[model samples]
Target: PVPVFKSELTGLTLPANAEIIAEGFIDPNELMDEGPFGEYTGYYSGNKGKDYPKPILRVERILHRNNPTMWSTTVGKPINDIHMIQSLNRTATLWHDLETMRVPGIEGVYIPAEACGRFWAVVSVRQKYPGHSNQVGNAVIASTTGHYGVKGVIVVDHDIAADDWDRVWWALSTRFDPKRSAQIIDRGRSTPLDPGLPIEAREITSRIILDACTPFEWTNKPNEIFMNREVLQKVSDRWNDYGFDGASPVANMIDRLVKPEAIKTKKK
Candidate 1:
């Protein structure tokens, strides 16, 4: 269980084991000029290095534990701690929101840290019927976690993981038909810090949703090529016969794609 205590300054419950707490109040009338700080987008967001007026916070009391430690991280560029946190948080939130909305057939969701976490999202869905792929794509944009900041969404088949970039690209190349798959929304809530839009028009932006799943309505669907499961098992069983390092090569994705009866085993 977690420990807690009441703050003398505000009579509010606080974490007793906290390193430090600075009680403060934001005065709406008191404004201060704040500068262009580095943002998660790897660029300065506050008026391109110019100071902007912001509400002022006044600290009235302070509390701390022994050897209190203060933690901080720089928010800039991709593959950083901030980007990773954004990815995990946004991904989980998107999945949760979709689940709460009772959107069916959602398999996976991923917010890539390389896309600044907020700009792009990839989703995997098992299409259930005609227009199911479109439903999922629109649902992503309407989700609580995805309604803001996200500029693009790529919806793929359940066979691919949302985080698998290679398979995602493959699906985009093979399954995506621009005329049918592309959806462009001209109006969206934009973040004020977004550099793509002019400072004056930062309140609105565009969004695009790309559906990469094969149409569920098609009766004569294209047969996907897959390796024979029997052959794969034979190779795994005879790994020692071949000169290779470590255990048999892991092919989790391939294994999932291939069914024993789907393709015939090649004659040895």
Candidate 2:
């Protein structure tokens, strides 16, 4: 039971923190098509088909704060406010939903803003078995956040960071074998605003789960070379002595990490 606020103009009862109050409801017996708006996909979707009789809201009156700074943003482009807002919100939802579902080995989840947080989601896992990745993927696919719109999910070993697209691609290329690692489901709920969907079939979609990890079945796998922690810490402590204006290894690590062949991995 959430607290409610009664709007003076429309007499609409809304959640206490709701910024705006409107009198709107839909009768399942009635339907109307709406949209063709600039969707978050960075394209115009849902505008091509016939107008379905979707729910229409009749705003009797509107009420807001005295000096409310209306938060708004444009779609059809990545790295904008819309994507940023969706990324934070959708990522939180995905994380929480995964936790609520009790999915094992759930290390991290990241829904990148550049994709509008709908098309692609990345999950990091400490896989316990060969099907652990699939289990995690299935749980995510069935979760509330993943039950709709998300077309692709990539599950990577816990060593990889979900937000690091560069490493995600690296894992995909090195760890994923198309014939063996791909999982496809024929049908699922689709994003209404997906331009890639046939105008008539935008309501349903298929999903792809790419298991971007070295299969647990293998006994011997190539070891990933990483910077020595002790050396890294020593370098961090002596960062000022190396004549850098800032006492951080970011400037030193960025290029070296990107171009690993440029530097020799220190051996014990």
Candidate 3:
């Protein structure tokens, strides 16, 4: 909270321990040019689209404490200032909003810190009926928080971990169909910081809903092959006997069986 105005001689009122103060009056009708600010998108956010004037604050008084410690921050880069500062609050808000939305099949919600916690999101859903994933995608787009700034929303199956990029990417590759599984919106609220759009178009951005889930209409899912538990257990029980060091039996078993190229391929 800012200091309140108290006495003319004292300027803005300060707490007993306070040492510095500055006073400003904002006339709502007064307008000024602002920005050319370095934004969280790692690009300069300049005046874009229609030039909207900014409010002007006129400083009338200044006071100082004996010594002051200034607090400031820098931005740009994913999971950095932009991500760290806003991710928690914004994700909480999104999760709350989605909860209230009551969209069917919704199991979990996440906003990727890689998008400064605003631009991209993922929703995990346990598909209960045909078109359930699409319902989630459209509902999220029209929901309160999703109506603004969010450029992309990916709906994944409940088995996929929304917060894990590896799982998300795997689902995206195997489940997403360029011809059928995407919802493309022509426009939605955007900001000047978006670098992918033209300056004039930054006021609104194209939204995409990428559905990374199997079609719920299917009668049966492809049976996935798995390693035998007995074999895995024997390997784990003998891991130390085989001289594998620094890793537990469970870790050794995983390393023995799972390889980057050996993941289940997408069903035809």
- lDDT tens digits, residues 111-132, model 1? 8999988889999999998998
Per-residue lDDT of model 2, residues 58-125, tens digit only: 55566566665576777777878889888898889999999999888888898889888677899999
Off by over 4 Å in 3: 1-20, 27-30, 60-69, 228-245, 248-268
Stretches > 4 Å off in candidate 2: 1-33, 55-68, 229-268
Model 3: weakest 10-residue lDDT segment is: 259-268
State every prediction's TM-score relative to the real structure: 0.83, 0.75, 0.79
Cα TM-score of candidate 1: 0.83
Superposing all C-alpha atoms, what RMSD in Å does each candidate have to the true structure? Answer: 4.2, 5.6, 6.0
Clashing pairs in 1: none
Give the alpha-carbon lDDT of every model. Answer: 0.85, 0.79, 0.77
**Cα RMSD for predicted model 2:** 5.6
